[model samples]
Target chain A: MNCEQARPLLAAYVDGELDTVRMLEMEGHLPACPACTRAVRELQQLQQSLRQESLYHPAPAALRRNVLAELSAQARPEPKPAFWSWFRLVPALSGAMVVCLAALLAVTLNRPSGHEQLTAEIVSSHIRSLMANHALDVVSTDQHTVKPWFNGRVDFAPPVKDLAAQGFPLIGGRLDYLHHRTVAALVFQRNKHIINVFLWPGSEKNSAPSLDSVRQGFNLIHWNQGGMTCWAISDLNPTELLEFTRDFAL
Target chain B: MEARERLPAFEQTVLPHLDAAHNLARWLAGNDQDAQDVVQEACLRAFKFFGGFRGDNPRAWLLAIVRNTFYTWLRQNRPAIPTVELDDAALEVADPAAAGEALQTRQADAETVRRAIAALPVEFREIIVLREMEAMSYKDIAILADLPIGTVMSRLARARKLLQKQLAREYQTGGPS
Candidate 1:
């Protein structure tokens, strides 16, 4: 790879984004070339500096507490199985249910085989929102406006608080559709950090506090607080969320 | 496996990625509280569809959920607020400390770098977080950002270039607080 050609690939090389063949080719060329080496060195320094800046600032503890509390509130109300349809006797109902059940059955029967599909859905939703520009509906710093806005749109009222005084201000509210029902999404901002709190009815059957973390790329903080489950998602480190939640109050 | 047995496995595979999800949510939401909300919402969505997760990277899946939750929240409520400058002084980079205790924290100079990163444009910053901080591959980044792999590489390169420039600017301006 010549200087001009290798220059573009330097970042990829540093990142190991190149395949083995490309990597070996770059390696062979790099030793004989000072310019590319220098360029590579500069890129490395730059990346290190950027990495240095990757310090995470977590969501405030109170926000987690408040969100969890709000979720727990609605969680106590178990979802009554869609009023056992008299339609169950109808052939059409049975047929439709059969199809849905088949799909569900296939999934349930092969839980381990569906990890990729599940991840894709999660990623798909994330990309969809960014491209679609429907990230938030209610835009306000007042919790009052955010909390009440969801009254009719969603079945449960999400706990909303304005943390403006504490540096994270309440932005408006919006209705989100998830788990087969409308849920409340309360928005907040901390510097450049945006917290999206989704409140919905939790399963009364599984009320244990649960937590999960993934490191494929972004960091996720998912925990069930009280009866309400809260997932604090961000690229920020878990420690930051811990700090944020520590200081967060409803 | 029974739904009962499968539930724990789902939790085991996906739950470990919650912090990663939370971090992504925090960056997208631009605040701790909003990030929490996004993470919570994403978790529910993730849980409901846990059965659909096949053999794939769970963290990216969860992050994808966070990203979706953030945008969904934005659409239904407010537009994404651009990360504003908190006056140069408040963000002024603290000087490298001379003493022992402060030196330890100052060694990496991570805090200042973080603030500088926070100040970047969302388009640029998101890629940076996904690639460098989170260490996602080009393909995964493409999937996450809905961009092509070429675009991901170029964007990540550009993001790095911008970070270097920002660091240089910080150095020239006497560092951030």
Candidate 2:
């Protein structure tokens, strides 16, 4: 592998694309040939420097909001025609049918018990927060700032800790309406992902945290700790979200 | 599937590559505002044709649309200027002056490097950005740029060499007095 033969293949060798035979051939020539070795080193250094360069520009938050809003607007279901006009023609029969329907609805709406309803509420709240660009009402990472910010907004103080060293940094907190009452939503960051931890006072004693359910690619973990029921939801993988809840439970 | 059903799949698979698409568009469009426009256009197009996208590489798929959208944008907005054509013959001939100064000790600043890249012909600039900055493989870049693998390799080599020459010139001019 003279310099001429080796020069063209140096880029490939640096990129780790060469076959084993070619790699061995290049390795054999590098010790004996100073110029080829330097060329290979230069290419490697150039590639490394380029990778380390901060050249990637992220899409602005406004762009993300705009794109999501456009998609949601397009996906909204069309409204059905009015049923009042048809019912007006047969008022006496309609009144009796409405009474029967109300009785049936009372039974059907009661089907989802407490836990299932809470799971659905938290999941929808997470999705709405993301889609509406309202993930955090107060944006601060300091646990002191975030924890105190929840005062006067919600009845109970949500525990806030900076788990940044553990790869889950506290983002901030927000007041969210869930379970027919106001709850504290302490937001956290896992890389670019957002995790919403909803906290409200619980009547029952402490219980072990466990995976509650998954809906629309978001995972939910429900647990009771120190007289508070915690529901943490995120699109982040289940294992990581579990680890997060475990850290919070401690 | 209904459009609403498809929205979740698109958000899970394709929306994550927004930064990658924006970065490529930023380089191709040469400014942040134009880049945003190009990326938004590309994303809408990607959503409309997402049913046809069967490949696993969502980033590459999104970037291909970005590249196409940028070219269409350039054609419509900057129609008077001809498409840049690299002089392969000239690039093949080595400039001995540049070759000698290329091994200088002085380092080029980030500004110099960026200016040099922005100064290159769009053809060279895009290939360099894809291969060097984006760290894409030759095959993926070829698909994105719609060029042969051999062409991609040769173009990248030339682009790097041109960058080195530009850096060498900066070093010679701005070295410690």
RMSD of each: 41.2, 33.9
Can you tell me which runs of candidate 1 are displaced by over 4 Å? A52-54, A57-250, B1-6, B80-108
Worst 10 residues of 2 chain A by lDDT: A44-53
Q: List model 2 lDDT by residue over A110-213, tens digit each.
A: 87888788888898899888897898899998999998998888878877888988899998888999999999998998988899999999846987778888
- lDDT per residue (tens digit) for residues A123-225 in model 1: 3443344456665787777777767777777766555667677666776666655445566665566666655555566643433222244535444444444
- DockQ per candidate, 2 decimals: 0.11, 0.20
User: Which digits, one per residue and each the tens of the lDDT, describe model 1 over residues B1-177?
Assistant: 334444567567876776667767776667776777777777767666767788579888877777877778977767556444424343343221212122122222676677667777666677887877788888998887788888777667666655665665565566642
**Model 1 chain A — which ten-residue stretch has the worst lDDT?**
A203-212
Error of 2 at A124 (Å): 72
Q: Which candidate number would show the highest DockQ if scored against the true structure?
A: 2
Runs in model 2 lying further than 4 Å from the true structure:
A77-250, B92-107, B175-177
TM-score of chain A of 1: 0.45
Which candidate number has the best TM-score? 2
DockQ of 2: 0.20
Q: Deviation in angstroms for B90 in model 2?
A: 3.7
